[model samples]
Target: MVAALLPRERLLMGPGPSTVPNRILRALAAPTLGHLDPQYIGYMDETCELMRQVFQTTNQLTFPVSGTGMAGMETILVNLIEPGDEVIVMINGVFGGRMKDNMERCGATVHAVEIPWGQSFTLDQIRQAVADHPQAVMLGIVHAETSTGAFQDLSGIGELLHQQGMLFAVDAVTSMGGHDLQVDAWGIDAIYSGTQKCLSCPPGLSPVSFSPLALEKIESRTTKSRSWYLDVSMLKNYYTGGGGRAYHHTAPINMVYALREALAIVVEEGLQPRFERHREMHQLLRSGLEELGLEYIPDHSLHTLNCVAVPDGVDEAAIRKRLLNEFDIEIGGGLGVFAGKAWRIGLMGESASEKNVLTMLAALKKCLGD
Candidate 1:
């Protein structure tokens, strides 16, 4: 017989799906509404406005796609790249590699710039890649490489690419609310982010934004996006256009509720203070980990996700097991090249608190002592 589903609750300190606030959970359980209901459409409009504020952009093409972060990636790529177009992909971690794969699937010729897993790409390297591929239509990069905790700087890359008449795209899934990102100020043409990482919400919706330049490219596509499900031109009409509440696919209404509440909390807290909170929490964890003779992996690490090298003779998997089974705390394991050699400890959104940092540090001391 199929039994009722119930999962044990633990402190979520992993790379994503951070602890949700109770208010957002209550919002998720609110009355269900039809996709085109006037009240529901009002909610959708308000949600887009909130996304614009959070993204620090005035772009009119901002909306939450009814899928995970990967869907956002596909949406941006498929809508912009037609067959035979050239693109420059920055691959310093797993997510960047995924971007390259998706670009290839869109039939774009990818010129990849590889870097060590725990390192961010240099401006000179990106400039050189652009010179090598002058015909590139876009440059795709990850702002926060979650797999290795490397924080890539996007300060000048946007203007550089825009000067070359190429689009500036970024994957900010792990850094959105936890780090500093000014979409309009930074000249980011198109960007996407996940709810779970720093929004203290579930992993369902991906907030995406496209500048007018990007929309123009989509409008000029030689062919329709290969994936109709992720086609942005049709999506904009449903999200906000002359069609007026037109139905595409059924929107994830409950996830939308949760996201709205989360964004409200972000507004209430303010962005700068929230980023400072993440910084302080990271410092606490870094000092404690350093005291225990642990070394950080990333050359320039993300304040939200901390990747540390596993000490010699210590069983990385066993330590993580003890932290979960004994302490009821959850952290992430490293991916790709850092697998088995590094542990990822995330201080993101609601989980980036002084108590959690101290608790994790003390718990780790006990486990290591044993």
Candidate 2:
């Protein structure tokens, strides 16, 4: 028989699933409530409200999907896109590539605009893509590319797309609470994010929001969404129907409690201050890494997730293993083209702290034999 499981605690400074605060852990341990329980409904409503505040949008379709961030991505794509529909996707990193894959799987005609892995798309590039693909229904991009630490600007792109009569979708999995995202002001038609990154919650739920225009497109779709589990029309009935809530699936009771607590923590600290904290911590980490003769990968780096180039002749895998086994600090390795050449050190949510920054710098210095 297996004994009671005991996992060693490590400081999580990785690409995602940042350190969960003790308060959130306590919330996760709260008594399990029925999926349709009146009390749980109250908590559910409050969670949606908190998510809207964090997303800075009044989208009525905003709620936490009962899966990871990828689920949220699929939810938006499948619901908004039908077979043969034209969509333009910006591919600068792994997540953007995944978006293109998902869009293709949805039977949509995807026009992938490729760029270098560690770079971001300029507004002119996006305009060119839109100009070339005049029939596209939506344009998707990643606000924070976790794999490469590229931060894409959404400032004028929304208005540009709106003028072209196209929907704007964003993958905000790594930027939700760590950066300043104005969904309404930016005119993002559809957006998806995870609770694990800047929210400091465990990896289970995905927070998503869809604008009225996106919902209108979904409503006007000729075919049903390929994914029944991710169909927003059905989900809206359960999350924000007219009368009594209809049972969809067994909601993740403890996880919702944890998300509520996490969002509450974010609200208490205030979004602007929290964003500033991540920026300051990233600068602190960047200065230390630069002193150690390291370089960054992205031209426009993300404050939440930092991807830095590893030094030549150093065994990156060995250093990562040593940091995990000896120092009990968990950082992430790179993905795609950056594999074996870069390290992704995340300053996300509760993990973004002065203490953690100093600790990581000291551990890495020792690992590098300096």
TM-score for candidate 1, residues paired by index? 0.98
lDDT of 1 by residue, 218-329 (tens): 9998798999888888899988764875678989998998899999888889999999999999999999999999999999999999999999999999999999999988
lDDT of 2 by residue, 1-370 (tens): 9899887788999998898889999999999999888999899999999999999999999999999999999999999999999999999999999999999999999999999999999999999999999899999999999999999999999999999999999999999999999999999999999999999999999999999999999989889999888888788988986446777778899999999999999999999999999999999999999999999999999999999998999989999999999999999998999999999999999999999999999999999984
In order, candidate lDDTs are: 0.92, 0.95
Q: Which stretches of candidate 1 lie over 4 Å from their true place?
A: none
lDDT of 1 at 23: 90
Best by lDDT: 2
TM-score of each: 0.98, 0.99
Task: Write down the worst ten-residue block by lDDT for model 2.
Answer: 241-250
